[model samples]
Target: MPGSGVSINALPKVSLHDHLDGGLRPATIIELAEAIDLDLPADTENDLADWFTAQATSGSLVDYLKTFDLTVAVMQTHDSLARVAREFVEDLALDGVIYGEIRWAPEQHLTAGLSLDQAVDAVQEGIEAGIDRVAQAGLVIKIGQVITAMRHADRSLEVAELAVRHRDLGVVGFDIAGAEQGFPAADHTEAFDFLARNLFPVTVHAGEADGLDSIRGALFDGRALRLGHGVRLAEDIEIGREDQDNTYVTLGPLAQWVRDREIPLELSPSSNLQTGAIAAWGDDMLDHPFDLLYQLGFRVTVNTDNRLMSGTSLSRELALLTDAFGYDLDDLEALQLNAASSAFLPLEEREELADAIVDGFANA
Candidate 1:
């Protein structure tokens, strides 16, 4: 799918912006919903999967997010969350993801009488079990939790504390997700301050639902090391003229800063299209700013924001980009390298992951 007669799914990849609640298997959701005696949009697994993809592609972020209500509802129990998370890892491993950060809001799962700590522990247990399953199959996969706090909610400080508390267990970083337009990162200043004081890594959901102001808030206010769906950062780039000879381009200060600093842009091709994130330019893959950002030397990393919602995988996202941008093996490897370097891991661990990517690509 990455061209050159090579299968993109066979390459070692890294996933940094996947949401746990958004990637559940349709069969699992059906079984869990039945176990809980909850209603569902569809009866069969195939019908349920089709329902989710259809609802998510409505070209509205709010509408797309509404699909999570069902997934989260069924995942309210400890066993359910663990099962969902375990399946999350198993899916990523099958997609050839060597390292992945699964982000989810623990606060959303407390309705079943589980504490914040317990929620994190259950996810960690599931992740460990998933890792063991992969190893037993003679494959390697590592998973981490990016404990997310709802941006519209006021428990960011508590969520930050939860992330720090579980840092040694399974949590690798902190994130602010959900409703990015009205809820500025400034609203969580106290949480950001605490995280900064503790040297915790942060990735903010900006440039997807909103514009430059949100991205600025994510950086200046939240101290984000990475931008989740930072595709709208393309707004900061000014295109002057195009000719057979060359195209004149100018970068706004914000774009220049992000490019200079090499902050990874978690670009989800399908999710961005489904949620109308790239509607400013057009409604097709060709209109996506991913290629422009990459050509201009921005640290752009491909992602599948929600595999089930978008009906995509990391390999599928890369293949879509390859088709849209005419990328080759080198381009695919570069994307993985960007994701590996941008992961919230220790320097040594990140280097090891990069080496693995290089080896995998070489063998490919």
Candidate 2:
């Protein structure tokens, strides 16, 4: 129980890259689907949960993304979106996350006769309701939305404007997500420029389905403040022969810049394995570059990129990393602090979150 002795859940944590649509609870998906008369691969809650995990880990790129279709189907309405968003917050609180930023594409939810503003309003209502529920339970939690635009689509400027418009309504940031290869952040330069002009924070989905070039584009073209699942940045790091003193490591230009800039890499261990993001290294959690990045002094934060698909949480992600890399409580604490520091909140609020995390870990 050395690792389990200090409950990962008891340590205050920050979630910086969680996906809203990917984090839907299976039971909630079931109820919402039933109400909408949508057919499901599994009817029972347990079976539905297993279906999501199985589909994600099936080794087929097509299968991995199919799970999102189910969750997205049930989220096409105002009531369903609000309900899912509320439960999304509640689940993070239960996982001991003191602060979280939920990311999702508003354009993907517009097929149900909901305007962009309406969808944002609905999710904000759910998020606030969830926060109130957590307070009633003698717990404290805060959540911010990171509105995303689909990289394969042409609505980024529109979505970027939507995010900026709702900044005061719990929207704190902007992002671009979708197939990484062939759809670089450069495609959305205008949107990125607009965001930059307005000083809105942005994170780009890079280094997951592609390599360092995509990450470079995310930073240079998108002006991203953080890299979502930027695990592949390890491609720029060279691991050399080991000597008596230590292992020789070399950083390429991009990796050097990222490290020197202290840009946080939102690494999701289980999701990376399931999606074959770390296949270049190996098909195991131990193959993940998370340990290498952290050990090398790069800003690395643990995440559950998609809880339902990966069957993981912030606590579970830490536990998996611990099992694979032999991380101790101190290592886990450092990861949370990195996430707190990289949050899109104002500097003062980020400092407050960091202090709260430090105190929570000290008490734990």
Candidate 3:
């Protein structure tokens, strides 16, 4: 097992569902918060980090999202946004992520008087700075921005246009995130239609806080190329019979379409458990549908939805899955390939990613 050792951090990987506001370093958050006179729940960096974890683990959507208000409050200015984005990439590269898509909503950042374009430029500046730092340290990594529109908010059309406006700079895809239960993807049909007409790639936050109907809306209304935390798609899978080695299963129409279409599921195992997205299944990682989706040939990709809240990295998430499902080096590589292939990048660039994954995993 020399080449295939289970040190998951050393494996080259791709992250698709990571949030920019959710992955800020604790120390940096304290500094930014202090500068802006923002009151925090904890005094020291470690305590603040622990507070984040505790709140996220409270299993309530309200509690889990409370952590973001703090993260986003400090991120109102261009400098803080740049610094946070810079560190986000640095951290991902240190964890051996070769490619990542960092998503955040610009409408939420305009409180500091920065225009939407200015906020994006600030993040781009930080990302480039972070990429340079990683490169100087002798590791190669690439990152792209996914401009997000809040699901409950009505500014998606504006955000979608912003995403398209910056496609050449750093923005890659469009996404609709936040409060997925009462809000459906169809509410933003105009934005999705605009993106579709303009040929912009989209990934909808579906099948996480909601169920199968939301996923159908994501595909039909949002024209989503991927599902964010789509672990709930497992709700549509019916177990027929099971024996010692063979288990028969059936996919519902929605599940069948998702599987046959091979739409990548950006399943964040830890975040799913933390947010109670998998509560119906159970409270443990063993109860996660990640292995079931993988066994059924779904394009399953592993991710860390919010590194800070979950107290995890991509490496740590993979390690958790490995522990829960007994996954090995090959399994990790397969997930990376799934993510790379499903990236919003151009087909040629995606193929290059595939080749890089092949080369990296070959060493394993």
Best by lDDT: 1
Where does model 1 exceed 4 Å of error? 242-245
Q: Count the backbone clashes (under 3 Å) in each candidate.
A: 0, 0, 0
Candidate 1's clash total is 0
Q: Write the per-residue lDDT of candidate 2 for residues 318-358, one digit (tens) a residue.
A: 88888888888788888999999999999999999999999
Candidate 3 clashes between residue pairs 3 or more apart in a chain or in different chains: none
RMSD of 1: 1.0
Q: Which 10 consecutive positions of candidate 1 have the poorest summed lDDT?
A: 1-10
Ranked by lDDT from best down, the candidates are 1, 3, 2
Q: Which candidate is the best by TM-score?
A: 1
* TM-score of every prediction relative to native: 0.98, 0.97, 0.97
Output the lDDT of residue 53, model 1: 99
True-vs-predicted CA distance for residue 211, candidate 2, Å: 0.5
Candidate 3 overall lDDT versus native: 0.92
**Cα lDDT for residue 122, model 2?**
90
Tens digit of per-residue lDDT, candidate 3, span 36-87: 8888999888998999999899776657887899899999999999999999
